[model samples]
Target: MIALLPLAVILPMIGAGVTMVASRRPRVQRALSVTALAAQLAVALIMLVVVDDRGPMVMHIGGWSAPFGITLVADRLAAFMLVVSTIVTLAVLIYSISQGRDDEEEDGTNSETPTSIFHPTFLILATGVSNAFLAGDLFNLFVSFEILLTASYVLLTLGGTTERLRAGAPYIVVSLLSSLIFLSGVAMVYAATGTVNLADLATKIDSVPPGIKATIAAILLTAFGVKAAVFPMSAWLPDSYPTAPAPVTAVFAGLLTKVGVYAIIRVQTLLFPGMFTTVLMVAAGATMLVGILGAIVQPGIKRMLSFTLVSHIGYMLFGVAIGSEAGVAAAIYYVAHHILVQTALFLGAGLIERVAGSTVLARLGGLAAAAPVLAVLFFIPAMNLAGVPPFSGFLGKVGLFEAALEGSTGAAQVLPLVIVCLGTLTSLLTLYAIVRVWGRAFWRPVPQAGEEHPPTGPLDPRGDHPMTTQYTESRRRAREAARRRMAAAEAARLPLGMVGATTAVVTVGLVLTVGAGPIYGLAERAAGNLMDQQTYVRAVMDTPADGAADLLIDPPGLSPAEPTAQDPGGTG
Candidate 1:
């Protein structure tokens, strides 16, 4: 079962090449991408069940063992993230295929044209995301980042349109700069600790001088903060995200920043426990306020959603900043919830654009009556994203608030409480932003030419013209056919493939709401595993009791203990 870990990474990589070869046959490419993701999702489920039943699973490539070879570990957190991400990728693949089919029809192109590379690049992106979650060492994590970044470069600039190029340029520059910083941090860690393996670092990092430890933490945090879109480092996300195609934006938004958050969780819990709590809290509050404010001001749906996405990340960071087992658990649950909800919202935004011929709130109207299904699809996830009651979003935030109140004390308590207030305020503001879009874009009547205001005329439930008597019965069929063709061309009525895929993902988000109990229990266990770094170290290193005692390196001022039979790996 541990061997299945690498297959999660390898299968998609292989499929990427296969997809490229089948690119000329769009149907073949689509089949390969979907099959690969389905298989990956199945493997992820197996890993989740196995890891939950047993414990963290580790595999060393070629049996080289420990820090000396490539290592893949699937703990509950990694397994859960992999499963959710694979689901999102699969849904997005179907959505992209639908878009591609529309493009092919519009251009009158045959399947053999090789006009798009969406499938191949998409698979490569999936490979990168899976690899990152499973990475057991720092260098491999860097490699995962590079792999995803390379794939994203292609995906972001897919059509080579002027807007895409402009968006892709800033994204590439920021990503490259962050990569350089990450590599430098990795080098510094290796230099100080003599190992880039996370398990090894969990032990060795404590022995480093306090100043050096702080430097390394700062460097790594800065690198990840940029990636995670934390406050003051999140300028790149809103602009870069909204310019890409719907599926691209959805996947990037859903998975990419969460990976950074995952890394931060690993770093803070496993490598440097209880460090920089105040700084994290401060950043968390600012990210929430700043991001939501940006969201509130946006006129376009994608840009507004992108800003809200950044804002909600602050909620995850709030959990991290609390620095407790409960906090970590809540953050993990929130990450999963956000991934589903955000992806659904973006996909829903795509539907809106299809119906209105734009995402601009001012240009859109009457979707509630004209496209009731789309309105429902958009409304559920929109409310979910806004942290509406009885939804996973609300539950996740409540968990974080509970954890914060439970964990904080004295002056520390004040900031966490302040953040709690701000978080609540942000939620209300999010609801306002989402509702503003819904009210203006869906409920309001469509504005007529030369009309100073939208007509308050009653809407027909069947979406008939209010003045139906004006059309002669003889002309009705021809008028209806013309309207049908126009609707199809404009995507006023969405394709089943697109709507079905979006609905599938939205259902998954609802599952998070319905299954929050067992899901959060799994998160609690994962958080415990994260806090007990020794279990992970032992799982990876396979050290004897005596060797484990020697490996134990507690932070300065703390005494190390001998390893017992039950605790072969000493406390990290």
Candidate 2:
């Protein structure tokens, strides 16, 4: 299984090429895409079990060793993420295939011929994601990001519509800016330490001057922060994501930002431990508050979910900031939970759009009455996202809170406690926002066509309230027209593929809840591995004298730190 690590990235790349070759055959493309992802998922699961049982596995590209050539490593953290992400990509691909490109304009865009670029681009995106998780060096990670971002650029503006183009503009700008920052960080890391290999950096970074270390850390954080959509850097997300098609939006929401979070975890735990702790905590609280506040006010369901997506990222960041074994473990668990729930919610939002013809809260109503199954589909994930009890979301939060409390004993207790409070508040407000959507979009009676209403005030001095009546009546007429259009739409029957795929994702979330113990146990061991740097460094660097191992050239004059399992708070 360890030897098969490269297949995670290779399978998708090959799948992308095959998909392009079969682009003329949509069914063939779909079959190829699904088969490739299913294989990748299987490989990832096997890697997870192997790494968890036998420790981190390292694969040197072209028979070159670490710090000298490209390396792909699958540790517990990387393997776990690979499993969760593969599940999401596969589910989203299935859902998209079921929805079909013919329904592309179903999201309200002008009708056009469906493009074949989607399957190839999607597989390429999956390849990028897998590569990022398994990348053993900063430069390889950077390359992985570029691969995915390039694929995303094509996916986001797939149809070349005005809305998608408009959204893609800022998204492209922000992504390019982040990529530039990340590239600069990689350059500086190489210059400072003479290697971009992560395990080697863990050992050698300590020898660099404090100022250089802090500068590199700050630079990397800024770049990854933008990628992760953390708070002030997060403004790009809600505006950018909602314009893409449903499946595109679902996969992006599920995996892309989490990859950034994964990078942040590596940087904080492996390269520069204990740097920027306070900054992460403060950023997490602010991200939660501002994101949820923005969420509650959005008129459209996708935009609202996007904001909540931003808000929940803060939770993951909070866990990283806590920098404890428990904190990181909880964060890891939460990341998996959020990926499934958030993806499901977005898919459910897509279903709602299909059923009601629009996702605008004002334009949507009586969904529960019209499509009860869709109502249930949307409701479960929404509740889970809101951290409702007995769900994985709630359990993940409880773990975070517990970790915070345990870590709050020292002089720095105040900040962690305050963040916990903010996290709780965010959860409550998220529930409120979810409920508001449920009421307006699912419970309230659908507006009748040409429904009439009384004037807001008496007639103006001229005994005619033209301003109020004109504005009010026009808005009312538009709403009624929307209602009539939706009512006239073909019966709201959801495609089995979309619903089954979504339900599959939702079931995975429930599996998280039911299997929280074993899964979180895996997270704890992953967190343990992250805190103990030598387990990773040795796996990559140590060579067996046995001829069974490949010929290796050791990095000269570089002394790695001794093998001591240090806590995340340790200042090396």
Candidate 3:
């Protein structure tokens, strides 16, 4: 059964290759891609259940021994991430099919370029993600990143339009540079240590001097920081992600940077275990500040959402930087919650752009006039993103705060205190940004005859507003009924095949919240297993090393997750 685990990853890689060859046909590609992802998701879910019941599962490729051949292992944490990544991919893929249909129908085009390219690259992206999470070796992790990055370059520029070109170029440049830096770090690590296997490195870290390990750690962190959109390295993300078409934007929002977070978690815990505190704390502080500040300044709905995504990412990193079981659990919980809420919000943002005629708040108005049900959808996830209570977001944040509180540091009082203040302020800023979107885009009236050509204002941290009554009685009544018929329209709007793809994926996110208790338990158990490292080592290697292991990752502060080292599935 464990040997079969690698086949799950293999299936999607094969599916992606086949889809790439058949890109000229949209329907065949959709059928195969959805089938591939559905199968992957099923496998991931099965693995999750199996791991829960039977403990972590590990497989060595080419029948090589642990820390020798490539190892694909599934622990509870990684399994949870596999499920999340696969689910997000499935959901947004369906959204893409619906997104481009209008032009396809209008132009008598059966195969739109972006829609056709979407399936192949999306599956490839999924494959890369699964590989990253399952990789037991550092070099294999690097390879996983390259696969994901290459797929992203295609997906990011799917349509090859001027706007996409403008957006994608920076993403490509930055991403490529980051990859190179990461590669350089990988080379240095191999030179310094005999093997690149994570478990091996963990056991071997005592042999490396602090200075040598620090240099390697700095190199890897910079590369992944760029990938994750941390503070200074985040410029490309807000610009690129927002300008892509909606479904692409949604997936990018939901999945891409999260991978970077996964990498950061992997490297900091597994590679530089105890040394992550000062630098990570500083990075987390800056990332949250700058990201939310950027969000505050962005004018359009997606752009704001994009910036906030980067901002809130810092919260999870803060937990990891703190490095305790509770912190890691918080990070994991947040990741699961954020994937759903962020993707949902981005998709809803796309709906706003389509129905409202613009993504900027200034141009939109009184969607309550036409699409109030969407307003509710938008509202739920937006509030969730803001870390409001009763939703998973709030719970995740509270957990992190508690972890931060219990841990002691020289700077502890200030860092945790600042985190609390910033969390509140950022939530307010996020709410403020969302409300600004609602004010002009949903609550107020659309511009009257020749009132203004819009998305026409400067991006502002705070926006100006003029209110009006845009919809009359009939329009208002129709808006109220939109809620009841939302699901029907969601189905009717898509052809049968397209509808099925979306329904299946979105259902996963909906279901995640339903089993929140068990999920949190899994996340916490995984965190505990990670902090101690004995369970993970035994799972990967079949036996604990008789002597010292090679990689001695510096665990961060004791307040948060100790930085789990298995693949890219970070708890947060």
Overall local distance difference test of candidate 1: 0.85
RMSD of 2: 5.9
TM-score of every model versus the real structure: 0.88, 0.91, 0.85
Please estimate how well model 3 matches the true structure, expressed as its whole-model Cα lDDT: 0.74
Q: lDDT by residue for model 3 over 1-572, one digit each (tens)?
A: 56447766887888888888888877778788878888888888888877766567777777677787887777777888898888888777766766556657767663334645677787888888899988888788888898988988887777677888888999999988999999998898888888888878878766888899889888988998898888888888988888777777778888888888887877676667667676777778778888888887776888888889899888888888878888888888888888888888887887766565568765566676566566766776777777666667778888888888886767657877777677767777878877777777767765453334333335445453222233244345544444333333333332333334334434444455567688888889778767877667766766323212222222333222433543234442
Judging by TM-score, tell me the better candidate of 1 and 2. 2
Could you tell me the lDDT of residue 515 within candidate 1?
A: 90
By TM-score rank, best first, the candidates go: 2, 1, 3
- List where candidate 2 sits over 4 angstroms from the true fold: 101-115, 449-490, 543-572
TM-score between candidate 1 and the true structure: 0.88
Q: Write model 1 residue lDDT over 1-572, tens digit each, in one string.
A: 55587789988998999988876777788888889999999999988887787567777776666788777888888999999999999998888788768757768652321334877888999999999999989999999999999999988877778988898899999999999999999999999998999998988998999999999999998898999999899999999999888888989999999999998998889888888888998899999999999999998999999999999999999899899999999999999999999999999898887776678876666778888899899999999999999999999999999999984589768988999999999999999999999998888866444232233467588865475564334245444543553354345657788899899999999998999899999899889888888868877887332222222223223334645433457543
Candidate 2: residue 384 Cα off by (Å): 0.6
Q: Which stretches of candidate 3 lie over 4 Å from their true place?
A: 110-116, 409-411, 453-514, 543-572
